[model samples]
Target: MTNKKDENKLIAERRSKLDLMREGGNAYPNDFRRDSLSGQLHQTFDAYKDETLREEHIRVAVSGRMMVKRLMGKASFIKLQDQSGQIQVRVERDSLPEGIYQRFKKWDVGDIVAAQGELFRTQTGELTILADEIRLLTKSLRPLPEKWHGLSDQEMRYRQRYVDLIINESSRNVFQKRSQIVTYMRSFLEAADFLEVETPMLQTTPGGANARPFKSHHNALDMELYLRIAPELNLKRLIVGGFDRVYEINRNFRNEGVSTQHNPEFTMMEAYRTYAEYTDWMDMTETMLHGMVDALNGSTLVSYQGEEFDFGKKFMRMTVEEAIEAYNPEFDMARIRDREYLADYCVKIGVNVQDNYGAGKLQIEIFDATGEAELREPTFITQYPTEVSPLSRKNDDDPFTADRFEFFVAGREIANGFSELNDPEDQASRFRAQVENAKAGDDEAMSYDHDYIRALEYGMPPTAGIGIGIDRLVMLLTNSASIRDVLLFPHMRPESFD
Candidate 1:
């Protein structure tokens, strides 16, 4: 047959099936009264070991999508899966009306149905339902993926997530845990007196973090706007407007590369507190995360990717210089002040260094290459160089370093916090330096916001702020290896229509 003829024939067959269903009744029914769920059935039968037919005589009205069917001439066994679990249904021709039985036989594996039945034990001792009546809830035109092998292709599973959720049990569990983790986090924050607030996702100037922003044009204003890379500046603006404690759990967009750890768009949680420092933020992080671990796992210890991690234990603390020394004792901190020497050392270790960058940038390169992955447990590497941390306050003892800390776990950076730079003059100078870097072809450098500087000129309070990558935290708590595993619908390339 020709391609066009085959297509026309398939369309005609689907129309005929639809017409038959319409004649029987509405194809999709409105009401399905489910009395007991699959999980509830399991709970009710938990104590019944010796299952005689008498104890299993309680009738249940259950509704679910038909997953599997074993049909005989006079009787059939069907599996129904609800949200909680799965239960088997036994339908005999003598039990249901002849017309309904005929319709049940016509039902496919993916069809939704409601069944009124009594519980019973099979010869294999599995708990099942003996159906007295059955009704079709919705007809599924498309066949489900294979039952046993499932949608095994990673790309296909991501692209067609509904099919993946139907066949793959593990995928559903990951998403369920993701929801639970977010709920626990929100409760923990609320209990701690943090007021959750939302800020604009699209902004005129993206000043929060050091990354390229995804730009969009505003047709109404005939101007360009950017999707926020982070919500730090706006949340702090709230702090300046007299909100002492504030947080936002929302999406951030970065026009950058995608990797196992990186996504073009992802969720983040940022919080700011009045009259606090990076040290206080570290303690808060430990407490919040330890509480989550206990709530989720009933203990502070969690095993992720073959390593045992304990969140309740005292987290290791070290300065950036100290971490560098711990990892590479041969390196001298005094020589780190020399830009040429630092640049050569960074190049030797395969660190990217621009010609205009100074010793501070080179030091960050070395830390990323050697120091970050050395951290296996929860640890805070503090006191970053002032040049690289433009928005952080300079250390009182050493003006060259900033009062900043980054939390690392399992060789990845999880959170960044700092005592914010409240000095308007100092902040202006730092912003100027960043502007120079941007002009020199540093696309990832932050833009200097004059309005933010003006807000600081009004004498903003001493404050501390932190941004935690929510997806990464979920990955850690759920023992998921990839960011894509935690995200329900991760970004993907568009498929070709042809």
Candidate 2:
């Protein structure tokens, strides 16, 4: 394909402008003083009528990219957009230097400019600034996306996030809300006596969760490390070290497939508290979510992807068996524990049942395939089978089930919590079982972490711990349909951007 020459011509023109700017003054000047945001100026003066605004002569200095421009013979109307929002600027020929006025006419829509002017109302009742002085702050080399069309291609949006953020109003709002959601969560945890902590992202063994990890090498120590799949194990060690309550909000890496809901790297909030059970975490989860939803939307009700969820209402609670039965009433309940029956059923259903896998694993597989999708409300599924919960304390009355609970909303897991396993001997045995699974070609199985077991020897308190995916939480709160929407720069295939 031949270059339309439009792009090249645009680039060449901007280069000429850059050279001209250097001759006249600095092409990229840093001395411009911006005393106000256009959004705030609008808010402060919007209430004033034309007569009041003109009488008060409210002078303000603002800086932003020129988003819209209409040049007349002796006057021009332009829209300048800053971090806050857009403001209109009206520049008369006599208001600025003759040379500067002529140069401003040639400036492109993407050019950064600073304007000092008096706030006034336009004939159409739109609030605007009558520019007394206008100076080019920075020259934009390339043009932005077409105004009416905007940036709508999803792949392009993720790959070139800066362009997406600049062109799309909703895109910027989503990220702004994402930051707020994280801030709200951190404050909530901090106020609850949870000390914010940081754990090593690089771990000798990724033991926290049964997820495949991305590995790296430490050259100095000649040791291999894995990007932590979850910070669970390290946070628990802090509990053993006498921290009563702790939380970490950071990144976790998993070697996994990408989807609307799945990313190789994601943010999460993991917290642990001493002397608390799985049930306590459940209550706290509900409370925190309720407050956050209110903070974001000013209500207990949250709407995501066309579904309404009542966060303030009491979350539904159920055992794994009860949840499975509720969602799949026709499923044979006896097959959940019948190892041979489940093994044959797994083969018939074309689901890979790992070799020597017990009925407990099969039970979860059944729930995942048939039941998990039906949990659309805030429901807590408790009493997870022991085989799938190595780091969780077993239920006192039932050896086969652990005191674990996963909160779900919109048919996806939102949070997971449990009473932690602290018995050194028991934990060692569980680790051994995982090692066996890993040996048998299960890459997602946890490793037998001797050091973590050694930490358990120091005796972690009766603790409740939970990890909530921050990306998904933002998705729900912002009504963002995909994980990529919340992430500013989601992973994308390498692309040519010229």
Candidate 3:
């Protein structure tokens, strides 16, 4: 979009400014230090009256980039912004050394500067810094975007995040809140005696989740590897190794299409606990979420994008069949269990269900088509079909369903967890089924990992594991509309300079 000619013209103008800056000793000086932030000044002095501030003579040294500037015949006003916030700076010909004010007049908006001044309120009641001395710390070569509507292009915003952070306070706040969310999650889990651990991102086999993997080759070893789609297997291996409880917050890679809810690479926090069941995990998850909401907002109720989600109340729990019945009473629960009936309904709803899919898998497709979008609040869809939940424990009373639960908020899955399938023989059988699924062109089906079966043979206790999409959680908590909005550098198609 930016043509070569216009780009060159701006470059030349900035270069001319750089020449003038070189005349000043050490144009990009780093030795300048600040005693306080702009936010600190406002916090400590915003309540003081103009006469009170002048009487107190609160001299403070601060440094930031020039965000706003208005020069008069002999005096000037500029807004200086730093990490914390922004404060106004007043400059007069008599305020600093005679030549310094003249030199400051030539400086541009994006230039970083250090100022030493006394705090006082302007006639309009703004907290201001009347500078006694000012110096440019770093000279910005390119001018900032236009004065008012700064960096509004969504694509440009993600591509150049530094500029986005500079112009948009809300954008910076989203990432800040994301950090808080992660911290709260980690702290809460640790408080409950869960150990945080690390797992390999690159693996010999992607056996954890049913997602397409990005494959790579290890040149040194002459072997193939995969960017792990999930850390489920490795984390469970830790469980077999005698660690009672563990959790990992890390990056996962999946060879998947880009969408509002998905990205190729994303963050997730997977946790496992020995001697725990799906019910135990569901309770812990709800308590942790409520604690997190309370910590961030002083309440457990959140308003996300105009929809009110009550995190304070207990979350709903229902079986997939129950949910389907609740959402669509017209569908016969008895007929839904029949393979042909479910398959026909799937086709009618435009959901592709292969013949390779068992009645359980077909039932899940029917549930997907009928019940998913009906969920508006926090709800746990439990009793997932065994065919689709390969690593989940099967119900003793009904082997057709696994003791699994997928947490949904605002109609999309945010977490998947279950009582882990620790029986070595059962796990092996499930892996073999997945292998057949893979052979049948289900690319997302997991590969067989004999090593995991061997680990299970050594005896893994009754363990529960859960994987929460950190990006999606951040999206919900921060009220971000898309996965891309939560992701600082979401993937995009290649761009051409021409």
Candidate 4:
């Protein structure tokens, strides 16, 4: 580890060079244009022989941060890193304009530089750029963290993400893959005729999910507002207004605890299709996921956290009760639907029992505690309790449960979908029940949005909606263990410089 004194000394030395550059009148220059990426150069030239490259005399301009610098008397080697990747640049004293080589020798490893050179192959068979011109673009004030040990401190990595991304290729790749994942999802949905729409991030009343919202006061209007926890309600309103198929990919905020799996602010893709049932959404989800896996990874199998999941196979599906029974064999299946039995079971399993809790809620609690984690494969746990799913339609044969399914992989919830509850009366009653729960001290309960109820009165067609957690999905696809790894700038505690 570099001690505070050593780090400060390095910084002072770099600052001295910056002071000299400032005296010369151009400490920062912005007019350098690059004609090639490091990766693209390697791709185009790696296959050719040294004689072929000399004959072709391919000239290109490249700019990136100097990652590696080997000062070897007359000739030196420095690797420049761009967005694509890094390429080796060979700088010779004889090849550069009179005093520039001296200045390049003083340049730090983290300095951004632009170089124009001819492509050539080194004696060792590696592609190289023999530069005739090199210009310092940006003077990096503080030296980057040691490249060998790299950025290993998790807190510091999240706090100083810019440094982390520069030093860690895996971190950069994860975010790149995250972008590709979102792009793939958007393209897939667009191909299916889903219209992308934006909804307000600030809401008058937060609904659509049972999560506490981050509150904000509108000073001009003298009214309270909230950062939306989910866009489910507004997206549904669009459905009622005649947009049969709608989707939104945006940020949602919640006043919640952070965990390996949870973030207070996160991204989600919520899509709704009118005249579609939960089952239809489930099938669409399967097709999309299967195709996504095949497209991104070139295979239907994914290895995550040492476990292999086969998207090639149909995702396992079972009712929530069945999942509970499958994971907890000792539970009496005959009394699974009994209210008193479920309450007792919940208490036996150390679940916090509430006065407003019903048999359906108890079953959900038990399942969450015992069954959720055991679902290591891609599985859809369906038939959620109506007590917990206020917006979902009640099952035709069983009014106690809703037509909902939560998709899980590696035991973490990834997506949730349900048949919409279009009946205004039923939805209103459920909203009242939620309000009562809030009054009874459930801070995560939903507030009744009367406007949504009014929208339902206008008669929305049978619709199905789903919200896919983009961060978690990225984690799964990119093999990132923490949600922080997938987020470029996840929320962190303020650092005390003192």
Candidate 5:
């Protein structure tokens, strides 16, 4: 909590400063305009130092927050940083009016200012601007973080992202890359004839993905609503409505634990295309990911957490059974129906297998615990057990497995796609099973949605759909290790209760 006295004291000081500025006839003038950016000026005139001509003089107006200041008796050197880049500003007492130099000396580092200056090269061969006049646009009351040390604390960086962006150059770059990656992804889908669509984020029944929902009350209707866990059900409805190719890049909310890989609210790009299956989605995933890597990294190869991963190379494809065999050769696949044997194996491997877990669920838990992290490169783990993949189409050869695949990179699941289950009866059965599981123990279970089943009954096309974790992809492209690094303002526990 803020102390009232301290708050009042700060407010009084700011008011006094404003009063003095207003009396000087330039409190908050809005007449200044910037003709060129700091970076554009540097790029255009950086090479004109040696062959100086009278006609080569360039006058540019630039505005930015002062980042650094070096003061001398009569002349001073400061660095002005705009959104494009930074340029050195050389201010001299002789250049400005008598009292203007003294006023400029009182300006702090974070104050926003506009300067009309001539471009030149400094003694150190650096591009600079020699300012003839400087106007203070806005004064920053709070002090910025130290220039050399930076905001090293993770919690503070996430909570106070503005400060983080100022002190940490890498943080700004990560967000820049994130924006570029999303823009490129949108272009890729649009070029492929996929129509971008919007879906409801709040639904009465949170269906589509197996996850716990954050619930809220609708005061007018006196009813309950859920923040959507996934936009799968509604997006598929578009398929039934004859929009064959559609995609949505949006946020999904889940009431879940937070980890380096997970956030309560995260972005996902979900798309559906008619007449395609999981195999078609696999090819699309590889091509799009390779393109993104090329755009950001200039190569398909990227390094993450000490491992070099190649996105361009053919991703390794394997079934769940194949992964199981490779990891545990001694496990008897024929005897997988034997619950006791599976339970014992789970205990040995330190998997949290509940007593209610059947053969398929236990296998998923074991695989996630042991095999997931071992997949360091891009690989598609396909043919997931049907019990855990309720909304996916069952394989023709084996009813126990689904025609699904999850793309893994850097030991993390980045994308999930499958041949969607379009059969209304089958989907209803699966939803029943998921509801039973939710009642029994699992909180992250799909809810029974009758409307979604009705939509399925109207005949959805045989479609292939995918949901790619956008934040995680941004992290990979930006070489960011934590979820917080890419997110500008990730959620955090309140530091003080008011």
Candidate 6:
């Protein structure tokens, strides 16, 4: 690591260079235009021999940041990296205008430059650009981190992401793959005839998910608003308004703790389809994810970290109680639904049992503590408890459980889906129950949204809804271990420069 003193010295040296450029009247030039990218040039001309390239005289212009410099007395080899990739430029003093090569020699690494030249192959058979002209485009004020060592501090990497992206190719590739994953998701949903829409980011009432919301006050209205925790309720309102299939890829805000699996501000894809049951969503999720794995990995298997999840085969579906029993057989299955028994078991197993927790909530708490992480394969844990899933429809035969499933892989939840509770009376009753839970000091309980209840009163068709965490999915696909690794600019504590 470079000490602060040494880093400041380097920045001062670069600043002096900038001062000289400023004296010459053009410290920053922006009119340089390039006709070719490094990757594209290599792709089109790599097959040609040195003699063939020189004979063909394929002229091109490229612009990128200078990454590597090898200066010999009168000639030099410098590598310029563009968005696509890197290319080598050969700068010869004899071939350029008088004094130009001397000026070029002073230009530092990390400086953005534009070069126009004909392509050739080096003696070592590497492709090169025999430049006729080169111009400095932007002067980088601070020197980049050393190339070989790169950015080693994880916290520093996240804090200074711009430098991380410039120095670390792997980091760049992760974000690139993130883009591909989101693009593939959008295309996949669009192909299914789902209409993409936008909902309010700032809401008067935060409905949808059970999470503490980040509050904001609307000064004009003199009313308090909230950054939406999820777009579920608004999307459902569109469903009630007769949109058969709708989806929103949105950012949700929650006043929550951060972890490798959680970000307070995160991206999610929420979709609702009318006349579709939760079971239909299960099928669609399987198909969509299976195809996605094949599209991204060219195989049905995703190797995340050390574990491999198979998407080709049918995703395993297990009930919450069954999973708990499978992972913790010491607990009595017969007493799984008994609130007192489950609460006692929870306390025994180190879960902080709350007094107001119902039987369904107790069962879920037990499952979360024991079973959630053990699900290594692509598995759908179904039949969530009604006490924990206020937005889900109650099962027909079992009133205590809701028609919901949380998709998990490699021990983390990536998606959640459930049948919509279309009955206005049932939804209203559930809202009242949630309000009561809030009154009992459950900070993560949902608020009773009368407008959403009114929307349901107008009669919505049987709908299925799902929210897929785009960040977590990207982490799985890109093999990134932390949620911050996938985010471009993750929230961080303010650092003191002094």
- Report the number of the highest-lDDT candidate: 4
Question: By the lDDT metric, which is better: model 1 or model 4?
Answer: 4
Q: Score candidate 1 by lDDT.
A: 0.87
Clashes of 5: 0
Return the TM-score for candidate 3, rounded to 2 decimals: 0.97
* lDDT, candidate 4, 1-498, per-residue tens: 234545687789999999999998889988899999999998888999999999999999999999999999989999999999999999999999998999899999999999998999998998999999999999998888898998898987998899999999999999888998899999999999999999999999998899999999999999999999999999999999999999999999989999888888999999999988999999999999999989999999999989999998999999999998998888999998898888888888899899888888899999999999999999999999998999999999998899999999999999999999999999999999999999999999999899999999999999999999999999999988999899999888776653
Ranking 1 against 2 by lDDT, winner: 2
Q: How do all models score by TM-score?
A: 0.93, 0.96, 0.97, 0.98, 0.95, 0.98
Q: Write the per-residue lDDT of candidate 3 for residues 1-498, one digit (tens) a residue.
A: 555644776667777888877885667788888999988888888899999999999898999989999999799999999989999999988988878888888888998988998998888999999999998888787778887988889998888788888888888989999999999999988998889999998898886888988999999999999998889999999999989999999999989889999999999999999988999989999999998998998888888889999999999999988987897766778886788887777787799988699889988887887788788899999999999999999998999999999999988899999999999999999989998998999988888899999999999999999999999999999899989888889898876777
Clashing pairs in 1: none
Residue-level error in angstroms, candidate 2, position 18: 1.8
Segments in model 3 whose C-alpha atoms lie over 4 Å from true places:
2-8
Error of 1 at 364 (Å): 0.5
Clashing residue pairs, backbone N/CA/C < 3 A, model 3: none
Candidate 4 off by > 4 Å: 1-7
Model 6: per-residue Cα lDDT over 40-97, one tens digit each:
9889889989999999888999999999999999999999999899999999998788
Better of 1 and 3 by TM-score: 3
Tens digit of per-residue lDDT, candidate 5, span 175-232: 8888998999999999999999999998998877888899999999999999999999
- Which segments of model 6 are wrong by more than 4 Å? 1-7
lDDT of each: 0.87, 0.90, 0.89, 0.93, 0.86, 0.92
Error of 3 at 357 (Å): 0.7
